[model samples]
Target chain A: MSPEAQEFLHTFVSESFYYWASVFMLLIHAGFLAYEGGASRVKNVLATMVKNLITLASVGLAFFFFGWWVYNAFPLFPMAGPILGPWTNPEASEAIKAAMPYVEGSYPWSSALGPNNADHMTGVFFFAFALFAMTTASIMSGALIERVKIGAYVFLSIILGGFTWLVAAAWGWNYFGWLFAKMGYHDFGCSGILHATAAFFTLGVLLNLGPRVGKYDPQGKPRQIMPHNLPLTMVGLLLIFIGFYAFLAACVIFLPGYEGETTIYGTPVTLASIGVSTTLALAAGLVGAYISAKADPFYTISGGLAGIISAAGGMDIYHPAVVMLIAFVGAFLMPKVAMFVERMGVDDAVGAIAVHGWCGVFGAVVVGVAAGGFPQGEGIPAINLGTQILGVVLFAGLLGFLPGYGCSWVMKRFDLLRVSPEEEVAGLDLADLGVPGYPEYATYEYVNEQLPVAQSSGSTKYAE
Target chain B: MQFSPLLAIFNPSPFQTHSEFLEVEGPFYTFAHQPGMIAFLLILCALGSIYFVYASFFIKGEQAGLKSPLALSLLLALGLGAVAERVYQQTLRQSDRPTSAVTRGVQMRSPQAPSPRLKPLALLGLVGGSAAASRRRRSSASRQRRIR
Candidate 1:
């Protein structure tokens, strides 16, 4: 084939591959919405889905307008400096322009519009990465399900999806990034940078938002928030794991370098190696989480996903046996963490804090032990246990937990966090959407007749 | 564990004792495999597992899915089989066959082009679909409550 043809084929195939992969990833959102909605009682489901649906739309625009740029420029750029300097420069190279969003014209797709190029492939590449930002933001939506104002949470997603994650990705995820080059940190696919960060962010909001009314008894005992629909939540989690494969693959450079052969098995760099690790890790996690639970549907399904995320950073190098062990550990811990949080009076509506935050933290730290070190060699911050802890502390604590909790705390001071007692029992949906989901049957009477009081705290009613 | 006394009689260490059984490879396994099989298997496994979990958990009522499970299992098996074959090919083969061309060609390659935005357009579709989902969920719940 002509060099030109090869280039075209490469560009066409890469672009197409990414485009379709992104479509599969998109299934995760629909699954998340359905699962979260089901986990939520009907009174609040419509509202919950609304929060999830608009998060993508609102956060998408936020990411387009500015989010994608932050990932490219923030690594070395001082935070206090001008945000647009590196990203929006009109003089950027063609390769850079070819990689951005909202370009109507061509070449050097202005930093304003994101880069563009004939030979370069930045637009879709940016999107491939951008998909992660969206997912990370969505992770938080479930935790703050019932009473968070739709507008407030949607706007929060813009910060998480468009700004915060991009900064962290730029700082930690970049190959030549300052943190990577100088600190010796190695997070293959953002166990700390993405999942852990988002999880803590959700916790911050929940802390300020407070637990759902009656989440604790008069004696402050915790109650179980059984899923309104178990099947949906489990399905949602599985879709998340499937989407994770694309998310993982997008981060890896599978193609051979110039003038070298791609190795497999004994030769090394085999695609099968990656596959085996991923599958075994997932299977192990599923088994581990299931065994721990006496047929607990929610935990078992979530365990499978926790399995993958835990192994992700190290999957590139781990043996299949080791990967499974790590996965099981990741999955089994989520429910335990959830129970701990409940005991502490922290109301996490979904297990986001455990599934994403706590497990994400473990995954990052585990890489140091399991891989024995990062693939990148020395001077990188990730090799040391302290640095991994630092990454988690910064991403999950300083950025996510502290800010989230502080902001939520301030919001709570004005009684903005919780709804009225009547509304709490009544639900956030009716208050926010101006529509009651149930019409003819008296709401409480019907709930009382059908479900036990413990199962009947349907706290949002916009669906009516 | 009750068989431990029998096992202790056989060997002092278990980790180093795999020699008790003869070593052999699966018939289909080989080391010349590339990313094509791996990538293919990854796709099949991902989709299949998703289907299995989805049906097992979410699908309810009379419309319980039948085809999905079979389809999923087949996809999963094919993916696993291909991946296993590829792994064996990589590990057992000792040739310096310049495998990059094969693997890269199979799974990925150098930069040439990027596909245009299906996403921006898809976002429009999502917007429309989500609107419909919101309304449908509401009305269905109301209808159920009314019947009750």
Candidate 2:
């Protein structure tokens, strides 16, 4: 093949690969829909699914216009002269040049941002990041399911997906990020940046949004809010298990000339290592979570996700056995953390805090312990416990919590955050969407009337 | 990296269809080729395939345990892996070069760079779009309250 033709072919295949990754990642949204739908009361199922779907639309568009730019622009904070400079200077590494905002074609109007012959990877890369951004929004969506106002939650999704998470990505996940350079922060698969950030954001929103009605009693004790559809929830989790490969795949760079592919931070990594580590983590996590939860299927599957998140930070470097062990620890500890948070009066509907937030922190911290001497970026300091801990605090507490709380607080002030008590009792679907999830079953009054008086109580309705 | 006889199929070196594999040295290759690692990995793969064949031919419900799901999962995984391998062979043909060099001057040729000043405008647009939706919701909420 001619040199030009070879280049073109390379571009086409590379773009196609990233695009496929983005498409596969959409399954995660489908999983979230079923997971949230099954977890919620029947009256609120459609509303939950709609909220999750709307996030894809709103966040997808918003990220295209701005989130992509944020990632490119903010990699350098106090010093950013290199941005928009010529790419051939050869002074700093390619990783640094790639991180410069709009310099390497991240501007919305840049030809590299779209389908241009001159650029093959830009569109697909942006699409992948856009999907990642949407995921951050979706994570928060599940935790505040029943009572959050649709508009308010959607607004938060726009900000979290389009702005906050992208900023965190620029700071840590980007190759030329100051944090990587100065603090030696390392997160290969974005445990802290994506999972932890989204998880903590959900926690913050839950704190401000408050628990769903009937979630707790006046005695400060928590109640078990069983999922309305366990089968759907389990199947949804299975889909997420399938979709997570795409999420991790997007975290890698598949460039033409690189031997083993590099990470977003330009560290040498391989899809093989990712595949092996994630699978081991998932298996170990399932077993661990099952054991810890006394074989509760929901937490057992969630433990699989927790294991992936926990091992994600170190997967790029960890041995398969080590990955499994780390994941096992994370999964085993996950439910206990959820219990502690519940005891603290925070009713996280889906255990997002423990699964994503705490596990993400655990993942980051353990990477520090396990891979302390690993290099973060070219010429930068190696990974250390201090830097990893700092990254956790920064991602989960500072960026995740503060923006989440402040945004929801502002919405609360405007009375835009929560549905009123009346709306909560009537069900969000009936109150907001004007339809019930199961219209046929909506008329179970006659069936209830025929039941024995003891079994006909409101609390026993779902038991049947 | 300690050898896990079970996971040797994930070793990247054996599947180097692309020329770049020869040029670039992966970090894991340093420890991956420990004396008996390759033979151990091969044995594991052979054992696994043999077990799979046996399970498909003979195992029944109670005795089958997790064999069916495991087999199905492996088939799907191998299909996806094939797709990935095809893409890698087709695309990753060139030597290592920075992405900056490849897309240089393209942005300049297209249009003016987006100013940092425009970021807030995009955010404002999101807020405005969400605000319109909220306004309708708030109006409906008030109507519900009055009726109650």
Candidate 3:
């Protein structure tokens, strides 16, 4: 084939690859829609679904306007001058230079952001990243459902999706990122950068947002608020598991002329490795959750997500067996971590903090231990335990927790963070949406009778 | 020089680069450019729809003595209006043939030329009309029940 012909073919393939990946990533939102809806009591189902849907729209726009730019601009933030990667003089590459946030086309108003014949990769790539941003925002959505104000949630989603997690990505997930270059931070699938950051952020929000009114008894003992539809929730989880394949695939960069796949950090990797490890980790997580939670359907399905996250950071290099082991341990410990969070008086409607945050930290830290002394890239530090631990602390604390807590705290002070107690008890669907997810089922007298007696008692047993 | 009235109405050239002129581009290029605009416009429409949906809820919440912030709803509506105006202006500029000032001026002066200012007003009218119709239907239904 002519060189130009080959180049065109390569560009087409690369563009189509990310395009399909973005399409598959849409399933994650679909899953979240069902998952949260099923998890919510019937009164709150539509409210739950609305929040999930709104996360996609709000985060998507925010990512296009600023999130992509932040990823490009801040790789060397808090420092000046370019940090050299394998591609010496990174600015020499047109693609890299055009993508730089300081560059004209990378900005929102740039023609490159609009329609241009010369660019095939930017739009598709931007879409993939936008989906990632939406996913990050959605991670926090489930945790604050039922009681959260939609307006407040939108504000939080924009900051987390468009700004904070991207900061973590620029610092850790990029090839020239400071964390990667100086400290050998290796989060190939963004366990630390995306999942942990969002999870910790959710934790911060939950701290300020408080728990559901009937989540606990007067003795400070936790009461189980069962999902309205266990089967639907499990099915939703399975869809998320499917979408996760695309998530991992998007992490691998397929350069047109390059021989094999590479991590975002430019380390050699293979799609086969990612596929195998992810599947094994998923299976391990299910088994672990099933055994540990004693076949509790909710925790078992949640374990599947927790498992993938646990091994995601090191899946590029870890053997399938090692992936399984890590996944199992993470899944097994998930219920315990969730219980601990509950003990602290926080109400996480879904176990997002445990699944994403704790497991993401475990995945990231395990990479330092398991993949220690591995060379990251040319001129970058080798993977080690200390840097991984530091990455977790920094990602969870500064990037994740602080903004989450600070924003939510301000919202709380203004009484804007949560719905009114009356609104909460009456259900967000009727109070906020003026519609119910299951209008027919919601009106059934028997369903109301079946609800926990504690809900109708108006007891302040759990109130602080 | 004269431009097609259809060009003014459709505004198909918003994304076409200066070099490309009227030449049809490759499939991917055409597809890429087309969807980006469609998606943007669709998102704006969806946002507008969501705002109206929530606005009704906010009013209801206030009527129920809940502290719903009407200011936030107004801010969102204003933001959407500004974005819609910018998009409309960009489309108008692109659709106006670049070589002929006379054509641009003529199109600008034409009474049929679409105005960006009408978008928000049109949106409000549509939403308000639907809301009023629903209110009437509800009141009549309640009156019939009272009579029964």
Best by lDDT: 3
lDDT, candidate 2, B1-148, per-residue tens:
1111111112222212222322346544311433254344345434533543554454222210111233334543664475355334323322232324423112111123233223223422432333344346556876999999
RMSD of 3: 25.7
Better of 2 and 3 by DockQ: 2
The two-chain DockQ for each candidate, comma-separated, is: 0.02, 0.02, 0.01
Q: Is the docking of candidate 3 incorrect, acceptable, medium or high quality?
A: incorrect
lDDT tens digits by residue: candidate 2, A1-464? 99988877777777887999899999889998899899988778899999989999889988877788877777766444343334435347655555543445776678787657666777788888888998889889889999999999889998889988888888888777777776778798788999999988888888889988998989987788888898998888877877788899878887765545777766667888788877888887886566555466678889999999998887777766557656876886677677767777888888889899989998987676555544444456666656788888988988899899999988988899999999998789888999878866733432454345536565565446
The ten-residue window of minimal lDDT in model 2 chain B covers B1-10
- Cα lDDT tens digits, model 1, A354-450, are 7888779989876654443222422232244445666677788766777667766776786665566676566766766766544454566455654
What is the C-alpha lDDT profile of model 3 across A1-464, one tens digit per residue? 99999999998899899999999999999999899999999889998999899998899889878787777777776653453232335466543464353334446776766777688877787889899999999999999999999999999999999999998988888766778877778888888889999999999999999889999999987787889988889889999999999999999999667766778877666787788888988887876565455466788899999999999998877655457666876786676577667767888888899899989998997776545445555556666656787889989999999999999999999999999999999899989989767754535433455334435676443221
Candidate order by decreasing TM-score:
2, 3, 1
**A400, model 2: CA deviation in Å?**
0.3
Off by over 4 Å in 3: A80-104, A442-464, B1-148
lDDT of 3: 0.74
